[model samples]
Target: MTIRLVLAGCGNMGYAMLSGWLKSGKLAPSAVLVVEPNAELRDRAVALGCGSAADAGAIPADAVPDLVVIAVKPQVIRDVTAAYKRFGDGRTTFVSIAAGTPSATFEDILGNRAPVVRCMPNTPAAIGKGMMVVFSNPLVSADAKRFVADLLSASGEVATIDDEGLMDAVTAVSGSGPAYIFHFIEALTVAAEKAGLPAATARLLAMQTVYGAASLAAESREDPAMLRKQVTSPNGTTAAALGVLMGDDRLTNLLTQAVEAARLRSIELGK
Candidate 1:
């Protein structure tokens, strides 16, 4: 099916998805309509050759989009959602990338019968290496889920959860996970500097190591644990470092605690 997308909000995530969808040839520039109140952002979309409207009401009244993607922040979602309620005609499946906002929130605004998919995507989506995790309401049809997944794959890896409750964990692991990786890189760079490397050299080493290791893990069929072991020989420097990181599974326990904290915060936000 030719999925005509009506994208609401053209902020960072929205623009990234639009770019990926277009660049990946998943969606034609002409097939997508951008609805953004911000003139600057809306103009960016139009510059990409998409149809733009200042508001949902401004969209041609006869237009019927297969998917209406809401990429606005959670705080203003309520105010923005009502404007597009007219499109909740069972044919259109609404997809939201708004964090901390539940599907029920959209149902409350767009009608309980509306088909909505709640998705969590990280900042990496801006560069097309994002992790997009989604959960759909029972009302959504099989074909609609498949269609939305196909579009989402343009951004990065697309995963679905059968239990909506697991979304909180997904949010903790992949949604807030990028920040953790960034912080790790920062810490590693600082450590390298303290170990006597110049600032620039330390920074480059830290980033390149992380990038190369992650790339290897992604492409290799071997488990990350196996790869780490492969690099660590008995009484070697890597083994020395592994001893510090794995002593009593210290790093594992710390990470588990961190993920739990994030998971609880995500649960609180949804409430």
Candidate 2:
């Protein structure tokens, strides 16, 4: 069956997912309707061989998309969802990647019968290395769930949860986790500069090191703690750094606080 996807935003994440779908042959470019109000972004989608619409009204009247992926901000999710009510019948399944917004919100807008999937995707999705997590309402079909998973897999690793409440932690870990990694990269770059390395070289080293370490961990599939131990020879330089980062549970305590703060913020946003 042909999959007609109505992507309701063209921001970085949306565009990235679209590019991945096209590149991976997961979704045909011809079946995608890029619903973006911004002229530049809509044009970018058109350039990639998909149909572009400035608003829901601009979409072809006869078009009943199999899936409507909402990538808008949490603040405007209600309005954007309301605008697409024409497809609220049981035939179309809705997928939202807006953090903090629950599937209940969409069901409330589209009617209780609507099948909504709430998703949290990190920014690394832009590079096709993101963590995409989703939770679907009971009304969602097995086929729809699989289809949505296939679409999201183009972005990166995709996982699902049975409890929607856990989405807050998901938001903190993967959704906000990229920003944490980026901040770490910045901090590492600065430290390298202070250690006598040139600014350009420091930045390159920081970025490459983080990237390589993460890639190795992912491919090795070994426990990260085990990997860290592998790198730390007894009483060596890496061990010295680990002492600072791990001794007294410093890094673990700090990261726990950060993630808790983010999870609380996610809960607040949902309210």
What C-alpha RMSD separates each model from the true structure? 1.5, 1.4
With a 3 Å backbone cut-off (N, CA, C), the pairs that clash in candidate 2 are: none
Candidate 2, residue 25: Cα displacement in angstroms equals 0.9
lDDT agreement of model 2 with the native = 0.92
Q: Give the TM-score (vs. native) of candidate 1.
A: 0.97
Structural similarity to truth (TM-score) of each candidate: 0.97, 0.96
* Best of the candidates, TM-score: 1
Most lDDT-accurate candidate: 2
Candidate 2 residues 1-271, lDDT tens each?
2439999999888999999999999888999999999999999999999998999998777778889999998899998989999889888999998989988889889997788998899888888888999999999999999999998898899999999999999999999998999999999999999999999999999999999999899899789999999999999999999899999999999999999999999999999
